[model samples]
Target: MRVSRTFRLPAAAVGLSLTAVLTLTACGSDNATDTAAGPLTVVASTNVWGSVAQSVAGDKVEVTSIITEPSSDPHSFETTPSDAAKVSDASLVVYNGGGYDPFVEDVLSSNGGNSDQRTVNAFGLLESQSQVRDQGEANEHVWYDVGTVDATAQAIADELGELDPGNAATYQANADTFSGRLKQITAVTDGIAATQGGAPVAQTEPIAHYLLEESSVRDVTPEGFTSAVENGNDPAAADIAATRQLFTDKQVRALVYNVQTDDDVTRDVRATAEAAGIPVVEVNETLPEGLDYIQWQTNTAKALAAALQ
Candidate 1:
């Protein structure tokens, strides 16, 4: 099958009133026969994406996520040679584009994995990550947004369904359930948007920008967020001063930040936010274990809403 020349706009757009489910379950029959059922093999870029795929693929696909450890950060990730072999062997691979997981793109370009393998680039499918030019001390954590996650889930389900026709019904059903939760999360985010306005926010990277943007909370974030994220280091004193002053000056409504990586500067920023009574929406480097991707995301969304309001 020929790859699409460009990412297609997902069926659901921003600000829409709910959406249809497109979840795909892992490929297999319930009788412990999926191993014998010849499930579609998959490799996902992030653990969160892997969970989303599992929710949709239920028993239809075998998904192996590249990152599963809680300490893993996409910005700091370095793909190993063994990772390449796993990706190359898969019938399908799902990754978030827009420089989120550059390694995934590298594997696809050089390895020439499978000519017919379905490659789902969720960032490419939904929005133009091209014009999205902000990676500062603010992390580039886009998966926190419900819509983006939902779009990624739909893409996985659609492709898995195409690859395994026999279990399409199960996949669709699972996708439906996942989609419903996403919609509910969206509503929760909307409520957050309604309550909070003009919040001063700063972070170590642009990781939560998409979700921040979705919430419509004013980010009086310092310019350092963008600069520090680009350099992969802490911001300069002046930028930090400006960020801190937002609180001292009483110009900030909240502080949205990443608490995954240990950095004195980020910790300082959090200190400033706390001292100023500014709520800090701390986002993890990735989804934690035990909770599904949807639950993980909703957890962050709830934090954002609380901080903003």
Candidate 2:
């Protein structure tokens, strides 16, 4: 028998039409099975979570991430039969829940073999750790928060241990080491808070909101503008004008642009910021190729710090 859990979508996810949610829920087949051998197989919705699992599991598990390209928008990712197959074969499946990757849930649900698998929903884990609440108010970019990521690493280690008890000690050690690196990443934010705290910044979306908050940077982007962009709607004319003025008037120290979800308005805003000589820092929702979770996040923090300077 397969076990299923109910996850409340974040408030922002309410925009996903009921039909779309139902469609996702109805995807995949119940005949899925774990076919891989030897080491445990892990499937992550995106490389951000995949990297964390890889770090904790080390050479003990083979991890596959569905969303790897930085140019891909995870929100619009379409699941395929291949992805379903990977989910089917995995001993562990990790995903960003809070509707960040509802398709993952759908795939697991339709595929019945997951009852014996270890599944880690980062959003749920963060909620259990008190790093966030299930009030549907939290941002889906939980990886941007160091504390949340640390907790997620520990959770992955624990789950991997349960699946492969022979290497439990090694997994715990790796997780502890990974947690220390996360602390170093947090230190970058601490340094920024000490020197550039309260610096006004702008964003095309809330993709990096958690990191900005940790760094003590004030996000001065118009909420309406960001909400419009995030929801795939045109920003209000007044909101656009107000945001453009923030750049032109040098009111914001930096413009943190989302590289994955560029649109005409966002492009215009970026060009406007550049024209006004405001530094623009590019951020992505997924981890880029070749860089692990710690490297990607640490580099992002360094870039933000440099831009603020």
Candidate 3:
């Protein structure tokens, strides 16, 4: 996980000031009406959440995602004046909060955004979920956690329903459908847990923390190594040696590699895993081209299962 950059206002020539009038009125405001001329609009920080919003909103909403390219790191993503205007004019803004996408929070705080803008935060939802919350600090990668995504999907539906009362039923129905599909994905991870609970694994970064937790795999990745990588620093030589030992010794059943943030250190770790005949499963922060959220996660869960086998 890369650190989120501090957001700064774009130049005035970019037209941020013009978006002040586009602010979304608070939900249930007495004078409020559907603010969009066509379908309702949802601006999401990344395509992963954008895909979820679309599933619940169906055809009644137009969704725009800021980080659609897989190569773009969400943490270091720079917001444009156009992005601000999109959020300002949107009926709902969905983001992975919890420091995962600071740019979104920055855009919300600038003059163009409203404090009352209807927004769905995945990390915030995770904290509120008693079923999922634990004593440990929660992972900011909530999208990989099935429970959080399900809750977020429902939250999006409720917000959309409130914004467009006539389509409330449709929004809710879509959420139900989306949740049901999520359960199917959960079942796959549950099966992995039931069959191979506590299987040892290692990761290049902590990006798949929740996913591995759901599958009941014991992650043996060195905290020092992952922390250093996440903070955009190189791991200490001792930590690097220890991580390589895991691969050379074949202590872990598989290596979960984040293909997005490649570096010489990670590449060597991956190469070590391959030389030892340990399965290397590549993971990404965003959806792959031609795949939706469900398909992408489903593939990840199954790939882990296969690697373990």
Specify the highest-lDDT model's number. Answer: 3
lDDT of 3 by residue, 1-309 (tens): 333322222222323443342343222222223554445789999999999999999999899998888778777776665676676657789999988887777666653324446889999899897564672768788899998999999999999999898999999999999999997678889999999899999998899999999999999989999877876788999999999999899999999998887788899999999999999999988878898889999999999999998
Compute the lDDT for candidate 2.
0.79
Each prediction's TM-score versus the true structure: 0.79, 0.86, 0.89
| Model 3 residue 171 CA deviation in Å | 0.5
lDDT of each: 0.64, 0.79, 0.82
| Candidate 3 Cα RMSD after full superposition onto the native fold (Å) | 4.1
**Which residue runs does candidate 2 get wrong by more than 4 Å?**
1-38, 131-136
Candidate 1, residue 81: lDDT: 60
How does model 3 score by TM-score?
0.89
Q: Pairs clashing in candidate 3?
A: none
Best by TM-score: 3
Residue-wise C-alpha lDDT for candidate 1, range 72-153, written one tens digit per residue = 6554455666676566556779887766676666555544323455687777655543346443332334576565667677
For model 3, the stretches where C-alpha displacement exceeds 4 angstroms are 1-33, 36-38, 130-132
Tell me which of candidates 1 and 2 scores higher on lDDT. Answer: 2
Stretches of candidate 1 above 4 Å error? 1-38, 128-140
RMSD of each: 10.9, 6.6, 4.1
